[model samples]
Target chain A: MCTYETSHVAVEGAGKGADGWFPVTEATVYFDHPVAAMAEHTLNLDFLNRARGASARVAVELDATSAYALAQAILERLEAAPPALTGELHRR
Target chain B: MRAMDEAMRAETVKFAGHGGDEIEGYLGQPLGGGPYGAVVVIHHMPGYDRESKEHVRRLAAAGFLALCPNLHVREAPGASPDDAAAAARAAGGVPDDRLVGDVAGAIAHLTALPSASGKVGTIGYCSGGRQSFLAACSLPLDAAVDCYGAFVVEAPPPERGLRMTPLLERAGDLSCPLLGLFGADDQFPAPAETARLGAELTRLGKAHELHTYEGAGHAFFSVDRPAYRVEAAVDGWRRVLAFFGEHLG
Candidate 1:
């Protein structure tokens, strides 16, 4: 039995080829255990279901590994590119 | 001139360009301004719709003489997606080349406006962002700001000219400072592409900066869309305003 942990949900503007414009939001699902992580990909139907809102499109997938890797890479890049604007107002 | 009392004015204006074609756009100016720095705003793929107009109004409030050109004037301003698709199909799936020329025309139109100072810059979103970089390459601009545009990519072969590679190749030719804001999760122009572009700009001795927002996806600057990251959008706008002030002033 595999258990899934929902982490973060993000909504973003995406390019629409012909349907004018629409919103795409994705939820991150984490495996509760290593066995769950290695076993069958968690089907996050609930995440997808919640993503359905006004003019909403949902893309649900289990990327426990890749998503973590990308996040790490982004943090590394930010570390390398020291913040240029420094002030109480500019800090975020 | 009362800051709160100065009403924002927006009007549809047309200009006869050197090419003898009539260029149309929405001009936004502060009601009590005596002359402001000019800014030419380019729309993304959807064209100069409501969002574009609203963006112009915001720029006007920022003390800029802003103009947003309707690149798809031949096509209906608010045409349905089906109609736009049919038109694209009729054109053999080719993106219009006239868009770049239209941007140049907009610059010319702004340069000649009574309330506009000769110093001009450009700001664009998505596809407009790529066009903003293209404007810097082909035209004389004080600065250019591109929001999540695929301006730097390897061009595909002639048989399959990728949608955006030309703008990337032309990045080396940029004469003015260019600021690019991107989202981390955007698949089209991934982080790797942006890193490569920064390297190329460094090699060419050009002044450029690329800022990526964490946990944000494409089109984060668009307030009307779900991808709107309020913090990132506000930060990006501040950076853009700072860039324009530094270069255009």
Candidate 2:
């Protein structure tokens, strides 16, 4: 249905794109028609470094179930980490 | 049948877009000697990718000069189409004023073509469909086609990040015949919304025709996507070509 909804976030991390690894400064998330995915609409996420240009991006398109599973897994893994190993200072 | 035998040329072009900014575009035209009508192909929300370019070439094969402006070029110069689309979306989509200006420049470029017949039209799909209606309301197009363009008669929810308003109020300014193609099962511009638009245009005495294909949903014309409905797409194309032929000739 061409859902124009989008969510943007500023992040501090590195992602592997076409040109090896680059620090991603932001992320854009949306559920919309995919560029490569065969589905009519999918959960799309783009890790981008705007300073490096639009080409500096890592993208993924996943179905709703897969996206939800991935999100839960991320939260579970993060929460399972010990406080000493994943301290507040180390987060940055 | 002639389209099957037509010799055509398709290539990348550069032109002045909104605010005279140099932007990239795709140009496609038949190699026939005589003059031909022109069409401005507005890329859908997914951006100026393969399918959009294919639309331009198809029009050229149908014996019309066609051009599609890269609406995301400014946001991500030289970026891949998908990345550029992401950038544009993050920027809250293109401004309406900018879209009108870019289409104006495209018309200027088209009419200047030596083989142009001085008549021009526009056809847009998805978001471009709404933009096509917007452009027709603002520009002097000979004809306009809106294929499942939502937000024309109703506003999107506030969280959608689409910085656009409903364009129904501008119907009085529509300078050409309009052909609306819709899917009955679509929720965005539900059948009721299209009906309202039809009613408004009728009251205003504007020349128009609208058809909603039952059992078809949004993006039915998108062959690469699961929403594709061959029956609807084929019929829609036939109507589009006929409309363009009548008005642009």
Candidate 3:
């Protein structure tokens, strides 16, 4: 079934899409039917540059376990960053 | 039955859609046939892709002038189907009123074809399934088929970002005979929900048939997905063809 569940976030980053590197301003996350994945459903993430159009998107579809692991890894790596470079100093 | 040797033509077309905006579509028709019945093939939520176009061709092979409009064309005109689908999803899915208008446009396009028989029906899969029912209720059609459509009797939770409301209330407005095919194990519109819809249609004295295959889950007819169940899909198609034949043949 198409879950139709979605979460959108505004993010500041760069993603490499079909053409090249582009500034990504939004991220949409959902668990639903995949366009090409063999699984019935997957954790889909789309990093998009809305201003650049729909083609300017970097998409990933991962199994639940893999998606959870990747999420943990991202948080771990960010926490391990040096305080000066982690943006914490800038917040101060 | 249609002769296997008959030629068919499939092509991309542009027509005025919702709000009088021009949208793209894929059209398929059997060649050398006189006035064939028409069907508007609505694509699943994944956008109008290769598989959806293939379905249109198959319908043409079955002797109908079939057309599938690009529901996401307004969101991303030149983008790939997947990208366009993603874009549409982020934009909170298609509005119900707009979907009806677009389908009405598709019906007009088909009826205007040289090979049209003046009779038109609608068949849709997944999200398209719900839209098929919506269009049938909102417009006059000869027949309507809803294949594993969700959220007809129940709406998604407010947080899901799918803004559609429960369409069961519109059952009274259905203008055509309706056929619904569902999977017993599908959760979106679970067996209970399907039963509820069936009961409501019956209470309203609408002409309809609702079937749920025991061994099939959602998207049992999706050939490329793991959810595809041959037996269920086969029987479902048989019923679909027969229903359309009775109403539009």
Using TM-score as the measure, name the better of candidate 2 and candidate 3.
3
- Residue by residue across B75-186, what tens digits does model 2's lDDT show? 9998889899998887788889999999999999989998899999999999998999999999998999999999999998876657779999999999999999999999
The top-ranked prediction according to DockQ is 3
Winner by DockQ between candidate 3 and candidate 1: 3
Q: Quote each prediction's TM-score.
A: 0.66, 0.96, 0.97
iRMS, all models: 17.6, 1.7, 1.4
Residue B161 C-alpha lDDT in model 1:
28
How does model 1 fare in lDDT? 0.64
* Runs off by more than 4 Å, candidate 2: A89-92, B1-4, B159-161
Tell me how far the alpha carbon of residue A86 in candidate 1 is from the true structure, in angstroms, after superposition: 69
Residue lDDT tens for model 3, B1-249: 352666799999999999999999999988865568889999999989998998899888888889999999999989999999999998888999889999999999999998888999999999999999999999999999999899988988787556788899999999999999999989977999999999999999999999999998889988988889999999998998888778888
Q: Top model by TM-score, which number?
A: 3
Output the TM-score of candidate 2.
0.96
Q: TM-score of each model's B chain?
A: 0.87, 0.97, 0.97
Ranking under DockQ, best-scoring first?
3, 2, 1
| DockQ for candidate 2 | 0.67
- Say which docking band candidate 3 falls in: medium
The lowest-lDDT stretch of 10 consecutive residues in candidate 1 chain B is B85-94
